[model samples]
Target: MNAQIALMLGQDGVTSGAIYALLAISIILVFSVTRILLVPQGEFVTFSALTMAAMQGGRPVRLGVLVLGLALAALVMDVVADRQRYRAWIWPKTSLALVAVGLVVVGLGLSVPFDRLGMLAQIAFTLATVVPLGPLIYRVFFQPIAAAPSLVLLMVAIAVHVALIGGGLLIFGPEGARTEPFSDAVIELGPAMIASQTLWVIGVSALLTIALGLFFEVSLWGKALRAAAFNRLGAELVGISPEFAGRTSMTLAALIGAVSGIVVAPITTIYYDSGFLISLKGFVGAIIGAMSSFSVAALGALLVGQTESFSTFWASTYKEIIVFTLLLPVLLWRSLRQGSVEDDE
Candidate 1:
């Protein structure tokens, strides 16, 4: 390949890699804080992308209905799980809050002219609609089984991933979509040109990464989450609530996933079921990190992105196989390094 082509491919790799890094970090955060592998994390990406595409196309966005329905289901779960606390005339504050947010989202989706809205408005609206699903899903699916074994949690995550795919099909239909670019500008370097959107992806990803690092290093709640990840029992004994940490981590995951979707949507077409493959790539990065170190996972994801990009150039038909094959050696090495243990469950 020529130098120009190689540079362009490298740019694509970095752009896609930034998004993968975000997903990897989100997966790591959720796994660390909650011990649940977030298989459906990619749904947030697809849903946000498709929703934005619909908005830009002047089509009505029906995501609010989902928000409302999931909110109601979560409320019911809350009541059923804690009958004594919710027996009074007043509803639980958390349930009421989510329901109210759902109603507001529904109202906005119905009342606003999304097509006429500015880019910022559409992005904000999209985030508002999709980000809440994370916490609601947590409350409905994972919260009840907080103490369950890892295998059970993984199975549940797989189920949720499947269900979300079906839900995506129902909500977004079977068609693929791409959104309008945030900008039409391009930058020319001696021999290569870069799309403005690629810069957007990389810039936003870096900012979010720095923000998260600061949050964990400087913020009290972030420290609490770290503490919980380090020692759940000790954190609870020290007055940190595991439930709060889980919900918070889920919220952050949703935000990261949604933003990733929004940023990358313009660069590629997204289908309802596309998230699984994207998230699976991110999972490879997470596994490379051994699911522990955030920096390692992000770096690994960048390598995955570069590998996938270059593989497509050389063996387009087998790019996926090439990307996935990376997991085998890493997994084998980890397995060999660790001692076997009995399952208490």
Candidate 2:
């Protein structure tokens, strides 16, 4: 391939890589803090994209309905599981807040002139409609089994992924959707012209990554999350609530997923089931880090993106296989290095 073609391919790689990096970081954050593989995180991406597309088309936004339903179920689960700890008259605070947020989002979806609204407003509405599903999901499904074995947690995560896929089908139907580009501007660098959407993706991903780093380093809640991720029992001993940490990390994951979806939607059509493969690509990056190091995972995701892009150019039919095959050597090296140990349990 010529230099211009290579440059264009590189641009595509960086754009898609930025999205994958966000997903990889989210996966690592959730896994470190909660030990639950967030297999369903991609649903947040698909749902957010579809929701934005629906708003742009002035169609009914069913995501609000899903959020409301999840909120109600989370509330019931919280009350039933923890009723002995609080007074019967007092509602579980988190669940109550989720329910309130759900109501507001639902109301907005039904009443707002989404088609007439500015792009920023639609993006905000999409975030509001999709982000809460993260914590609500954690509260309803994973919270009760927080102390379960890692294998059990993984199984539960897979189950949740399946459920969300069904929910996506019901909410978004069969059609694929894409949104308008965030900007029409393009940048010229030497022989190559870069799309504005590519810049948006890279800029937003970088900003979020820096913001997250600052949060972990400077904010109290971020410190708490760090503590929980580092050592759950120790964090609990020091008065950091594990539940709060789990929910917070899940919230961050959802926010990342939603933003990734919004940013990428204009560039690619997204269907209800599209998130699985997209997220699976990110999972490969997480594996490259052994699901522990954020920076490593981000870099690994970038590599995956570049590899996928070039593979698509060369052998379109086997691009996925080429991308996934990257995991084998990394896994083999890690396994050989660490060997196996019997479970203490």
Please give the CA lDDT of all the candidate structures: 0.92, 0.93
Q: 1-345, model 1: which lDDT tens digit per residue?
A: 999999998988888888888999999999999999999999999999999999998888888998899899988877776776666554557867889989999998888889998899999999999999999889889998999998899999999999999989998899999999999999998989988999999999999999999999999999999999999999999999988999999999999999999999999999999999999999998989989989999999999999999999999999999999999998898888886756647
TM-score of each: 0.96, 0.97
- The collision pairs in model 1 are none
- In candidate 1, position 341 carries an lDDT of 50
Cα-based lDDT at residue 133, candidate 1: 92
Query: How well does candidate 1 score on lDDT at residue 222?
Result: 96
Instruction: Give the per-residue Cα lDDT of candidate 2 at 108.
Output: 90
